[model samples]
Target: MDDMIAGGCQCGAIRYSLAGPLPPAYACHCGECKKQSASAFSMSIPLDYDQLQVEGTPISFTTTAFSGRAKHNFFCANCGTRLWHSGSIPPDSITLKVGSLDDSSGIAPQGHLWVSKKQAGIKLDQAIEQFDTQPDDVTEWRGNLGQNS
Candidate 1:
């Protein structure tokens, strides 16, 4: 069994607990990510959807991703803090914005994605792998996984 990670929105109105090790975290430099975060990039941890449980309802806004997939951005309706994002990947897995976590010190991004959209003056360490676009290998693997079966 994996340890549980507890977190919530800034206002504590939306609480969530994620069990098991989070999937490899990624720093996304896509335009939409930057726009939403108002930063150079957005860090996220992808976890099985069923493994995530929220205490309150989160507002969702659907938008087209760079891949042309319909991505839903979920946030605490009260505070409007972006909490998680869901897309066409697997219903069992959704990406949680790292910023939403109460304790983010344990989470470190393993790599950077959508490097092509990265902003200037944002220097990334050489230790992590950088991809110009979404990693095809991860997509294939996620697509093949059965949803909470």
Candidate 2:
């Protein structure tokens, strides 16, 4: 990905620009993620909260994840397209949906999380590490990606 990337919702609303090194993408297979994404999993790239700039207002809903931590899900009010998620789950960073990127060309998930809640029939890459649940520390779970400073 570029040092700076741009993306938005399905419609024209809720545009965002991310500047700085983009983290490798990761997948979450928890039930809430599957339900919100309507897919086997939700793919996201974590960015420093200060590195992202969002334009236009997004309707947000707060809910607790399988981890029991609260999160605020942001979506386009017009088309209701899910965008990014923010909250206590990751603390200082916002989880930007990879699919929302204007160009997702070379982006791919580096690992999988919440595999314990993964739905049946879902298959994951055996090459990448899969966590039954969140690791004790993000650093241990994401390797160097968690070393962001």
Candidate 3:
């Protein structure tokens, strides 16, 4: 965590630098995430909004979350690489897409969300903290992942 983590869009239009200490990432199996990732699940690392410094303008679209709050998705205009997501409910944080990282070799999801929608072919560690849907208690959820985070 001493060195800075950097990444950018495929076309190199939108670049970002993420500061440490990095928070634990999570694998989301929600339908929206699957569509966004075009895969079985989407990986996200939540950090303070300012922790991720952006260098270029990114086009964004708004979508409503299950919480009924507006969630904004930002992507590169050139390569259509989805960068991150921000929600109105939590104005101070951003969910950085793990795929956008230049070197994600060291990152791994500490928890899973929307497990009910998880792909049939995917297998998860039984010991990992997971939920069929969003956990009701943020504290409990965080506590469960604290060891790994």
Best by lDDT: 3
Task: Output the lDDT of residue 122, model 1.
Answer: 85
Best candidate, TM-score:
3
Q: Write the per-residue lDDT of candidate 1 for residues 83-121, one digit (tens) a residue.
A: 888884444458888898777787767778889999998
- Residue 49 local lDDT, model 1: 72
What are the per-residue Cα lDDT tens digits for candidate 2 across 122-143? 8887877778987778544554
Model 1 scores a TM of 0.84
Clash count, one per candidate: 1, 0, 0
Model 2 Cα shift for residue 53 (angstroms): 2.1
> In model 3, how large is the Cα lDDT of residue 138?
45
| Candidate models: Cα lDDT each | 0.78, 0.80, 0.83
Clashing residue pairs in candidate 3, if any?
A: none
RMSD of 1: 4.8
Q: What is the lDDT of residue 53 in candidate 3?
A: 81
Model 2 accuracy (lDDT, Cα): 0.80
Using lDDT as the measure, what is the rank order of every candidate, best first?
Answer: 3, 2, 1
